[model samples]
Target: MTEQRFSRRRLIAVSGAALAVPAVARAQDVPAAAPLHRRNTMSFVPQNWQDHFDGLGIAAIVADTTSRALHFWSGDGETYKVYPTSVPRTDELTKRGYTEIVRKRVGPDWTPTPNMLKEDPTLEYMPPGPGNPLGTHAMYLSWPAYLIHGTHDTRKIGRQSSSGCIGLYNHMVEELFAMAPVGTQVRII
Candidate 1:
């Protein structure tokens, strides 16, 4: 056999090209518009406060049930925030329309609503603690038993898991709690 010399650089180049050929071919084989299965995950579409509120009076919050998101705008209209949230479990439990933040509490206690007790008698009054459903902070709406609060269970966020309240992650609620003052206009759609 004739003596053959192969440089390391040439060998590396050849090997790299060989490896890349399959990847390039595979990429081309994929269809440009392949259908993808839908997922149950948090995906926020940017919302304009003007569309939902007349003005950002003391701040404005819109809890969108279909998108499972909460949008906030500061009173001066300088700051805007979007947070993934857990909506009411069902339409029957959902209270849509306008309301305002009537009260705010840090470490809020949980008293099961009369309707809630009727549904599940086991739900007792839970004091503010680890077990409390209304996580670290709560902003009570004008509507009774309806609140936008944090949840201890992280899994509840971005799902239909609340009895009637809008649920946010504990840290997110704490942030929102600080931003939205009492009398902040709220719209649940």
Candidate 2:
């Protein structure tokens, strides 16, 4: 596919506008910057993922349609997923079971990539395969390129290992697909 370049100024404007195009309350997953010393390790295990899932206080699942299931749930600093979905937080509230109001659109040209990818170029722009943290699936949050998805590596699932993106297992993500609609409520704990 042909690539289009969005000027930084334009990107900033567009991102800002994107915030308004989709109406929503502030996302729950946004967290204060962590201490530079590191609070905990980042992992992509089912147990950790589950803990994060349950942490959202069971309000609504800000589901990550991506293969990586990290953003599958929302929580506090312990498991914060960035760019939370702007859609409704519950199926009971609307006809649409779930919907992502602002999914970060990523093509060949994207700006301000995740910290992990920025720190490690080998990981970013990698082809689909082992070590590709993007995994086989990626359901993006409203934040650009930030997603709740699967991972090629399972060890990094639960912790804050991504560049503001949620990570999960490919198989687990397939299961997540059956759970709801495109507009489902996604509440980051």
Candidate 3:
């Protein structure tokens, strides 16, 4: 065989192009108005997530901050659901721990947290409605000052754009609220 050599910069460029091809292809395959639930968007799921799910005998909620996705594994362990989610924008604000659902509400109100108000004093509490940031449902977590809630801004889903909470699409949150009762274990990774 003949000896061959490749430049480092050429290898990096070729590798980047190879990685981008799949993302471009996936984007083209998805319809413009299609909901994320109907799309194949689990590219960010951890390789060993299924192994953890297999060991769980109880229902659980798992959030991967890096992936910006939430997984609901049923008690049966054989069934699971994934939802596109928006997580805290900064690593400092993203928390990882074991907690449980403390409460659940429908058409939840939006009261700006103390930190939020400090950022913008003009912000006011919002009543439950379409315009509310907490769109249709909210699940309070055992951890203080944290929650998993629906968002009115659908464009933010699958992104890192929240203050310190997990945000889901309205319909997906509604479905999740129905399936996840109070006291469900929530593990953030």
Candidate 4:
């Protein structure tokens, strides 16, 4: 009876430790909001916008609204990275156009736009932190109030959840912010 009790306790402890390993590994895979310059070389052939950007020698971003995916292309025309993103939620906010990065901010505070405030009057300014809607970093677009920003709610990625801005996972946005400088061309389709 003593030997069986000891074995059961040992097994429970071992099982708990085993369950912890994958959690630790997953945590390590997420990049912190630091200046990390790692390149993501995942490739996908552009379905709709390839002809528009083929042979273009400038670093650019292309967002596919249908797939809710963002593709970053290097100067060489190869996809540097691909990340799941959240796009505009409503038809009025969803439109395709050309834009450029107007500004970049690290841990940016979010002020609700006029439209947002109209929709939710109680919404107010959000200071930078985990609770902030604009998580970690943001790259504002020249297109008025639109932006490519990180989100605290990572589950929103790969869905249409934002008013108009593009939302990436916090870790992915950190990597993208490091790669995309201001004035980088962005084309949404």
Which candidate, 1 or 2, has the higher TM-score? 1
Using lDDT, give the best candidate's number: 1
Worst 10 residues of 4 by lDDT: 40-49
Stretches of candidate 1 exceeding 4 Å from the true structure: 1-40
Which numbered prediction scores highest in TM-score against the true structure?
1
Tens-digit lDDT track of model 2 for 33-132:
7444433333222323444333344223543323222253332334333222222223331221233523321121223456545666655355555555
Q: Looking at model 3, which ten-residue stretch has the lowest summed lDDT?
A: 46-55
Clashes of each: 0, 35, 0, 0
The superposed Cα distance between candidate 1 and the true structure at residue 186, in angstroms, equals: 0.3
lDDT of 1 by residue, 45-67 (tens): 67888898878889999999888
Cα lDDT of model 4 by residue, 6-27, tens digit: 6888999999999999999977
- TM-scores, one per candidate: 0.81, 0.41, 0.73, 0.72
Q: Which lDDT tens digits does candidate 3 get at residues 1-189?
A: 997789999899999999999999999988879876755543467533454444554568898887788988766667678888989888888888888799999988888889888878999989999889888999999988789999999988888888789999999999999888787788888
- Using TM-score as the measure, name the better of candidate 1 and candidate 3: 1
